[model samples]
Target: MKAAPPKATFAICGVTLLSFALLSATDRFADAAVLGGFIPARLSGLAVPYALPVWLTPLSATLLHGGLLHLGFNLLMLYFCGRDDEVALGRPGVVLLYVLGAYGAAAAHYAVGPHSTSPMVGASGAISALVGAYAILYGQRRPSKFSPEVARWLHIARLAAAWIAVQLMLGLVSRTQGLAIAWAAHVGGFLVGLIIARPLLRWRYRKA
Candidate 1:
């Protein structure tokens, strides 16, 4: 049988592309980032003219990107992981993961730097959730010396550590190059994915 189309993934990518194109064309990248991106300080009563509500910024931030390269990388990840996840989780499950991931990432960022004024933009945090789900859904399980429960938790712990290390390294590299990377958001989003993957899978096939 032919594979099902990943309509939700395509729709997300298309919207993100259009948003970046419009912002770039109008030279409104900064404007959009301020108005739409998640600003941790905003949660603490920082005021801006016509800015999106603090609660909504997390979702809106996913629609904005710093540059073509930023947008491209996120879209690529979304396409690969999102498509495969859609097959297992179905469209609603995938969408739930992405949305929750964005909020989870924002929460983590705020917890770490609540007073930060920097605007966090890009779908990477949200996509990190998808990447986490992909890793769990498709990762090979190794025979373990420990009991099943202990082994499962250990596997999760290992994956989480690896992801955190990678994000930390990326953060260091970006900092050296005078670019900001939301490594905390990535870790937070990935953890959310890992936590939800099994539940969502069971939910998807509950009747089966």
Candidate 2:
């Protein structure tokens, strides 16, 4: 008989890409917070195919980041928060979460800072959304940390929720004084990821 297909892991390529992105960001921003200097830039949503104009830094800045400290934490978060979604949603679902989460983040940042040069670059926006969806899916279940069942990871659910609420609230309140927090991106990405992940989760729970 043919073997069953392998299940997906949390974070998946998001973690890896984030890892390398952090490395690049670190190499470039070791001295100062050079936001969008590194990482992938989107040219024109559909024009660049997947990259942005370097001059349009702060616009899609979250796509970039700096330092292992930043990257490591983000990737780690993605791993934990991303698991349930990946396991339940499958690899393709994971990809959808990442992509949609990215769009959510980028959309928020772009809308907030259409004319700013702050440069929003990082995986937090996307990861936060994955965390959001994961939290919503399994927030009330699991052990709130480690679970013997791979399908019921709890620690991630808690952290993801906390992170999303904290970031969004902070960014919104702080933005009034010209202080940006990328909260919009977090909220937008998370909501999008959560919506996209819903059906995938349902599909995974079907009885044989």
Candidate 3:
């Protein structure tokens, strides 16, 4: 059977790419980041110069990227994991995951640094959710001496540990480079994905 096109993924990638290009070209990238990016201080009632509403910044932040490398990495992950996830969860499910992931990332970021003035940009946090869902939906199961349930949880624990380690390393690297990486947002987004993967799957195939 022929597979359905991943319209949701394509749309998201297209919009994100176009948004970055237009903002960069018009020299409004900085403005956009300040106005649209998720700022932890915004949640703490910090006023800004004509910025978007605090509640909407998380979704808006997904459309902004720091640089070509940042955008490329996110789009690539979205294309791969998103296409496959769309197949299992359908368009709505994928969109749901992405949107929820963005908010989840922002919330986590805020929790860690409520007074932070840095604006969190890029789609990585949202993409992390998709990656998390992908891990759950398609991750390989290995042979283990433990019972199936115990082994399953152990597998999740390992994945979580590995993810955190990688994020911490990335955070360290970014710190040295004078760039901030929201490792907390990534962790939060991934947790959201892991928590919702089964429910979304069941919702998709409810009639089956």
Q: Write the per-residue lDDT of candidate 1 for residues 1-208, one digit (tens) a residue.
A: 8779999999998999999888888988888889999999998989989998889999999998776566676788889989999999999999999999999999988999999999988787898899889878876468878886777667766766775676566555555534488878988898889889989999999999
CA lDDT of each prediction against the hidden true structure: 0.85, 0.58, 0.86
Q: Candidate 3, which segments miss by more than 4 Å at Cα?
A: 141-178
lDDT score of residue 172 within candidate 2: 63
- Candidate 3 per-residue lDDT, tens place, 75-113, comes to 988899899999989999999999999999998999999
Q: Which is better, 2 or 3, measured by TM-score?
A: 3
**Per-residue CA lDDT of candidate 2, range 15-78, in tens?**
4565466656566442223433322223333222233455444333444444445556666677
Sort by TM-score, top down from the best: 3, 1, 2
Clash number for model 1? 0
| Model 3 alpha-carbon miss at residue 11, Å | 1.1
Q: How accurate is candidate 3 locally (lDDT)?
A: 0.86
- lDDT of candidate model 2 versus the reference: 0.58
Worst 10-residue stretch by lDDT in candidate 1? 170-179
